[model samples]
Target: MLREETAKLLMMIQGAYPNYKPDNKTVTINTWNLALSDISFDLAEKAFLAYLRADTKGFAPAPGQLIALVHELNTPQQLNELEAWSLVEKAIRNSIYNSQEEFSKLPPLVQKAVGSPNVLRLWAADGSYSEQVASSNFMRSYRNEAKKQEEYEKLPADMQQMIDQTNRNSYSAQIREKNRDAIQIMTTTENAEIEVKDEPTGISQQSDERLKKLIEDFRKI
Candidate 1:
C-alpha cells in the first residue's frame, strides 16, 4: 500500500511537471509519510522507478491510484504544456510540499502522522531540525492516537461491522475523542470489553498528588 501510494504520488508530480527540481527535502518524503506511513527510502525508490515506467509505456497505475486518476481528469488527451505545468504546481503543493497549515487540516490519522518527527525522519538530517521539528507532546499524542486507531483496525469484521463509516459518519467524528474512548466509540459496542490505558501516574502518593496537579497544569502548555 505504501509503495503504491508513493508510486501514484510521484507519478502525479513527475507526469505533471517533468522539469521541476526534485526537492527530496521540500518534497516527496514528508507528505508521503503522512499519507502513507511505513514508506521508506526503498519504497520511494521503487515508486520513482515505476513512475519512470508509467511515463515510458503510459501503463495504467495500480487500483488505488488517486493522483493518477486526478491528473487524468485534469488533462485527458495530450496536455498543453501550460495545463500540465499548472497541474504539476498543484500536485507539488498538494503532495510533494509540506505546509504546516495543510498538515493541520489533514484527517486525524494523517494529521497525527504529520504531527510526529518520526514521520518526517528523512528531513531530520537536512539541517532543518531547529526550524521544522515536531513537538514531543504532539508526537506522543500522535503515536498514542495512532496506536488506538491500529487497535480499532485490527478488530474482527464480524465483531464490529460498518455500513457507512465515511468521513461524514462514525469514522471521522470519533477520531477527535481522547484516545481510549475514541477506540471504544469506533468498535466496542459492549464498552465492557474495551481496553484503556492506565490513568496518568505521579512519582509517589502525597507528593504524587502535587506532581499530578503540576503535570496537568504544565499540559495546559
Candidate 2:
C-alpha cells in the first residue's frame, strides 16, 4: 500500500486505542508502508476491521498481525477430513462399473490422494481391503495437501513466483537426467551387438556345429 493509505490505517488504529500514541509518526508510517506495500489498501482495511472485532487485548495491531488476518480472509472455505472421506467412500462403492466417471467426480484434492480410477477399482475388487485403513490413509493425505495449499496461498506473490520457478527447474533437471540414462543404455546395447558381430568366424562356426550335434542327439533319443 502507499504511504498515504498506511497512514490512514494507522489513524484508524489510533482512534480505536487511546493509549496507542507513537512517538515518531513518520517512522511508524514508513515502517507500516514498507511491510504492507504488497497488500491492497482495501484488503488491509478489511483486515484491520476484522482484527478490531476479534481482538480483546485493546492494543493496536502490528503490520504482521494485519498480514495474517488478510491471509485468513483470502483463504477459501474447504471441507473437513470426514466430509472428504465420506465422498471417497461413496465413490468407491459406485466405482465397480464406472471407475473413471466416479474418479472424475471427486474434488481435486481428494482425487490427488486417491491417485487414479484404477486404484479405486482395485480397492473395490479386493475383499481383503480394509475400509478403516483406507479411511485413515486418505484422511492423513488430505490433511497434508490442505495444509500445503494453505501455506502456499499465504505466501507473497514474489515468493510464490520464486517457488514455482524452482519447481520448474527441478522438473527440467529430472527430465534431462532420464534422457541421459536412456541414451547411455542404448549406446551400451549397440556396442554389445557390434562386439558379437565382430567375434572370430572360427568360434562362431564351432558353436553352430555343437548346437546342430546336440539337436541330432536329442532326436535320436
Candidate 3:
C-alpha cells in the first residue's frame, strides 16, 4: 500500500522538476530516496504522509548523497505516461536535499507550483489512478443510482425508472479524486461492491445498505 502511495508522490514531484529550464540553477526542493527503510499495509497511510513531509523543514534533502540514492528504485519502463511521470516525481521528492538558501533563493513561480496542495496530492497517488478511485466515494452514489437502475430493470412491468438519465449533450461529469489522507474509503468501496448485491432484496427495496454505509463513512472526511 505504501508502495502505491510512494508511486503517486513520485509522479507529483516530477511536475516540480519539469524539463523546462529555470533561470536559477538552484533546486528548490531536493527529493532524496523514496524507498522507505521499511513499510507494510498497517503504516500505509501515515507512511504516505511522512514522504511528503520529508521535503519540509526537518526532512530537507541532502547534497549529492541523497539525490544519488534515488536511482536505485526500479519502476517499470512500461509504465503509462502518467505512471512514468509519477515515478520520477517520487524520486525527486524523496531524494536527498535541504531547504538551503539556494532553494529558497529561487523565484515565487517555482515555489508555488512545486509546493501546491494539488501537486502534492497528484504525486501522492503516483498518478491520478488511486486518486480517481478515491473520488468514487460520494460520486459512487451515482453507481448506486446505476445499480438502482439495474435493480429497476429487474422489477415487474408495473415499476418505474426513477433514475434521471443525463442528456448526451450535457454530459459533464465531476471527477472525485483520491489522496493519501482519504484512501481508506476507497477500500471500503471494493468491499461494498462485492457484498452489495441486488438479488437478496430486489430492486423494489433497492437496499444497497452496505454501499451506503461505506459512502457515508467517506463523507465524514
Which one wins on lDDT?
2
Better of 2 and 3 by lDDT: 2
* TM-score, predicted candidate 3 vs. hidden true structure: 0.18
lDDT of the candidates, in the order given: 0.41, 0.79, 0.35
Q: Is candidate 1 or 2 superior in TM-score?
A: 2
TM, every model: 0.21, 0.64, 0.18
Which regions in candidate 2 have their CA more than 4 angstroms from the true location?
21-28, 94-101, 115-118, 171-221
lDDT of 3 by residue, 1-221 (tens): 25454444434444544543334323222221223323233343333344445545333223222222232122122223343334334433532221222223323323222432333334444543454453333234333443444444333233332232332223232112222222333333333445666443443133345445646654664
Considering summed lDDT, which 10 consecutive residues are worst modelled in model 1? Answer: 183-192
Off by over 4 Å in 1: 1-110, 115-133, 163-167, 170-221
What's the CA RMSD of model 1 in angstroms?
19.9
Alpha-carbon lDDT of model 2: 0.79
| Per-residue lDDT over 1-221 for candidate 2, one digit per residue giving the tens place of the 0 to 100 score | 88899999999999999899999999999988988889999999999999999899888898888988898887768889999999999999976555667877999888867866667767887889999999999899999998887777767789999998897679555554454343334333434445677764655566555545645544453
Per model, state how many residue pairs clash.
0, 1, 27
Worst 10 residues of 2 by lDDT: 179-188
Instruction: Report the error of model 1 at residue 138, Å.
Output: 2.8
Q: Which sections of candidate 3 miss by over 4 Å?
A: 1-207
